[model samples]
Target: MSSTATTTEAAPTVELSTLPLRGGEKKAEEKAEEYKYAHLLPHFSEDRYPPLEPYKHIDPGHRALKHANPRAFLDSAERVVELTPHLGTDVKGINLANLDSDGRDQLALEVARRGLMVFRDQRDFIDRGPEFYKKWGQHFGRLHVHPTSGHPKGYPEIHLVYRDGNTSFNFEVDDSITTTVWHSDVSYELQPPGLTTFFLLASPPTGGDTLFTSQVSALKKLSPQFVAFLKTLKAIHSGVEQAEFSRAGRRGGIVRRDPVEHVHPVVRKHPVTGEEALYVNRQFTRRIVGLKREESEAILRLLYDHIDKSADNQARVKWEPNTIVLWDNRVTAHSANVDFRHLPDARHGARITPQAERPQPALEGLDLSA
Candidate 1:
């Protein structure tokens, strides 16, 4: 293995405290304590609210290039195929496991321009183990440690996602489970993940395709008046409120940390591209701050419907073994297609989320409120 890649040969065992607490295992005292202090934590914090700013669209030329023959922009060294009008690109002829510093830097720039990028035939990645994945993730930023789904053995940043037909550990339990719906990865954290990369180890014959939609497109499609309103809003995102870990029971590699919640801008500006994108997601965003519950729900429902139902904003990736997908979580929302649930070992993959700073609205000084 190259120095840039990390191996799992000396993988360490995850500590028991790091795993999520199993159902019915919490003592009565712990339950009593939780009830006592739960009310003290405000539903949302005002300090985290985003400042209202004038609405202005900064059209980075990347979107224009995407519309005007995206393939024509590809360099000779790599074949870049655009997957959708707004998001997703397929990059061919680069081996992820062996990428030098310069190649990795170029790949990052492409992902910034295109919300999501896919690299097919990454069999060498699987052979390199969890360390290889971790190292690649490190190039962008610090790796995120999932609060519920614990990291793989030695590499504390890799989230191991797996499903088998016989087990109850599926993505969605019922239609009511919001966590299984479309969402940006770990939006509940104060510093949500900026980028995520997933490598498929096993994929069923058909199905298990992941869909990604651009938040940039989602924001642009809304009425200008509504976009102005969204700039002044903040939403509460919570991991404990969603309660996926408690409902699903204790599973291996699932860390049992205390639930965390944070307030984030409803519309965020991408740090690198300076593009504005809708930050609220169905899975983690509990409610919009400073609004009546009814009003918030109506507005959120409209935004959610726009994001999930819009075909023009989406790009779909059909997973195959040895395939790798990288997406900018800051600008994209994704959902896994569970159509192959009936098949044993339907889908399996490892993911790494790179840490990012708090989100800020991308409002330019145009005074659109008038």
Candidate 2:
């Protein structure tokens, strides 16, 4: 990852009173009712992205895996290879596209326990087109439409992360779009994705490996006092504007829905596992609600640093052609390596996001002070 200095600037202000209302547009009162939390939306400076602190260091010595027990849920037929102690497992001998009802149930249980599962040398889903890919994701839950990325025609649920010769969404063109920045997919949504699966159609011969980290491990490493304090906080997440999508000139089935902004707990519970994880990420979490600007910046920076610097909590997966990687968004954060940008055969892949329940803090019965 490259180090670039980010300067802090005042956020741009928007005045609803000065904007002209179009014909047939809802009245101000109706619009207010529709978007009741519009005032909480984050405003970024033209040249800046939120959570401004960059990763200070990448430590390689962190190798502790917390609460990972795949054998407890997986049976003998499933071959599980642990990629790292903290997160990521490579499952062999099972084809996702050809899974039976019993196999599907067992796979889901393994994924929830492992946080991420990688399957290499897969041909069943790759040979089929977008529809087959969509079907595989729907087995888990409803697919989510990305606010900015392009999807295949008639398929709003699939986002194409391609860079073929004729592709419009080129990864090399923009420095702002690198995947090295750690984030959970679509954390901006009111109900963020429960799971995200990526299938690599074409990958470079070398480079473009992705890094996955466990947020469950991240929270566990923090002091109990700080964890208790984090449970009491919420953070704001805002969606990408339509104009931003237009400027990129990427094509997909646009939903044309109103922009979204919402508040979510800083510490969120995994709906399936019932475990607590630190939820605020570098990508979409704007600020800690009700905190002073300076205080919010300081605390957010500290948390981001902890997530990034904890080398023991991450696993690196190199992409292979016809490979599929599925991760639980509620428990993990990932970063993609952009080292293959100069290669003529650009990396191409498809991503599917499974719908998730709204985030809630897991503080019902646990003793925080222990």
Candidate 3:
């Protein structure tokens, strides 16, 4: 039940009407979010496209494969010669302009496909501190303002944390497997985050690492039968389900900024690639369409269990101070591990600025069932 503390007006709201859909026409889509067992597949045409379910689950999709190591495929001998860890991955200091335009685009595309990308031994950039976040972040997109407990400081662009005394968020928890749970940031809003960038200002001496998993990859891994089943449904996602404390003394105790609920396609298409992905996450996805309470619970439980059970499908990044991690919020889910307790408090070196996402309705011709 804490207030935003900052005096600045809340970040600009995300309105559905502002987004540019293919046609200027406005139409009411089906309100299937309440249905318990309704899936997405049977409702749409099957022949227009292949079941996107398979694409969501696969290890290497046809598109990702085509561009696999394009550095190897298209680069000259000099491009292959760079062996520095920072140069190899997505993080190349703050100046992306220094990179070859095509190479930079390819790396950004790779980051989009991989969900998360990292840079190591990043000292120069991290030392510059909070102000540094503003420079590169503004170039990316509109910086997000937290609807509620935004940041301790007035600056909406950053969330500052340090190991010493009373500063801001005391991000300390007394458990080792701290982040075994999965979550997407701020799903309570209509326009969920499109992307996120978090850099590690300080890291533990030993084991604190972050795990990233591709929701699209996980969805593609599901059995065709299950994918078909899920396609027929939409789920309700609300912050009220989690942040109970935020709703202290209200009628429903729901601290909702927008009274109207936002509904998204059960399966999402990549904004850039046009390839589809199964986009639900445990923290945000609440229930299935058309099914009764018990039925929806059963389906959700199975899915919740399945995502955790499938471990090989994920990637983990061990933290090093000054390491910057950027990810596409639409396609990935992240969790923090608490093994760093012995080292000291893990302070955020800079702020987390997430981009605004455009809401898109699922195209009518697509099929969820193969």
Candidate 4:
């Protein structure tokens, strides 16, 4: 049984009680990192949100439904536009908060196929507050508590996603873009997020859009021989970076959860759509198993480049103040545009990610016996 080697270096121990929930609260040093980039808005914050227990969410909900109809889901939508041929679909004139159970079920199936769903002017959803947003995610599946990110004071299910000029995450590139760390949310977990809903609270007038690329399209762009070879491999996804984020206390001080690692197939099959998608992301996928470091790096680089350059199948979402994007984390990779970081204004949003079933191999007709 071949496997990848896990990290052995000791990480510094930071007690949970000492962790501050927001910046401007306390700083251990003048240059401490914990008080950097933020996700929680100060007005909507509380002091401490407890950590999640070591638990697993087993779900066979929307993915197992056989009679879902995408057209029916869009019947109430005033305007339905596909942001890209393969990636994001914008459905206007619909309040997601009022979606019935059947509508929600059908919408979930469509999200799995479309990779991303966008709804603008979501005043109803926004006004309902964070608790309502958490409950909406709960309807899809078991809501995931982010392992090492900041949230509203009492809300752990809603992960705060925000950016401001005050944070150190801004770039100073001549090209207007220096880095694009594309990833699925928490792919290192045993059961990574399936359907994730991100509601935009605010955005700059000109920038702070999100770019999503289709992993299914990336997989299809590969040659048959290359994909066949990839099916025999699995990639290691680690939470080392996320743990470092907590240790550094990016949003004031967050409870430092121990990092985790999970192995997923290089090509994972969508539970509902049954389409194969390239599963390795630049953010968390560490290395491919049973290969030398250089060999794994080369192959992973090729795949990452393939996804990064897939502009035709990519979608750029220009966020409005009350926009909500629901996406399948298993089928798409997204990166935030931080171009507005030069402005004093902040781009803020809250996300509720529902963890789904484990990644399944796309191999159905391939050999079963080892």
TM-score of each: 0.75, 0.73, 0.63, 0.82
Q: Give Cα-based local distance difference scores for all models.
A: 0.63, 0.61, 0.47, 0.69
lDDT per residue (tens digit) for residues 247-283 in model 3: 4421112232422234555666666555556656676
For model 1, residues 74-113, the per-residue Cα lDDT tens digits are 4543676789877998877667777665556556656767
Between the candidate structures 3 and 4, which one is better when assessed by lDDT?
Answer: 4
Model 2's lDDT to the true fold? 0.61
Residue 178, model 4, lDDT: 49
Q: Indicate which candidate wins on TM-score.
A: 4
Q: For candidate 2, which ten residues in a row score worst on lDDT?
A: 2-11
Which ranges of candidate 1 are over 4 A from the true structure?
Answer: 1-78, 168-171, 175-180, 242-244, 247-255, 364-370
lDDT of 4 by residue, 1-370 (tens): 0001111111112222223454432331232233222223422234343544444553333433755454576787789998877888998988888887777887788888889999877877777877787778887778887655656656777776545445522111235344466789889877888988886555555766678889999888889999999998888998886667555645443444567787888888987778899999888999988789999999999988887887876888866656788889999998866666576544556778888877887875433121
The residue ranges of model 3 lying beyond 4 angstroms of the native Cα positions read 1-107, 150-152, 160-178, 241-243, 246-261, 342-346, 349-351, 359-370
TM-score of 1: 0.75
Please give the ranking of all candidate structures by TM-score, highest first, separated by commas. 4, 1, 2, 3
What candidate 4 gets wrong by more than 4 Å, as runs, is 1-70, 168-177, 364-370
Give candidate 3's root-mean-square deviation (CA, Å). Answer: 15.5
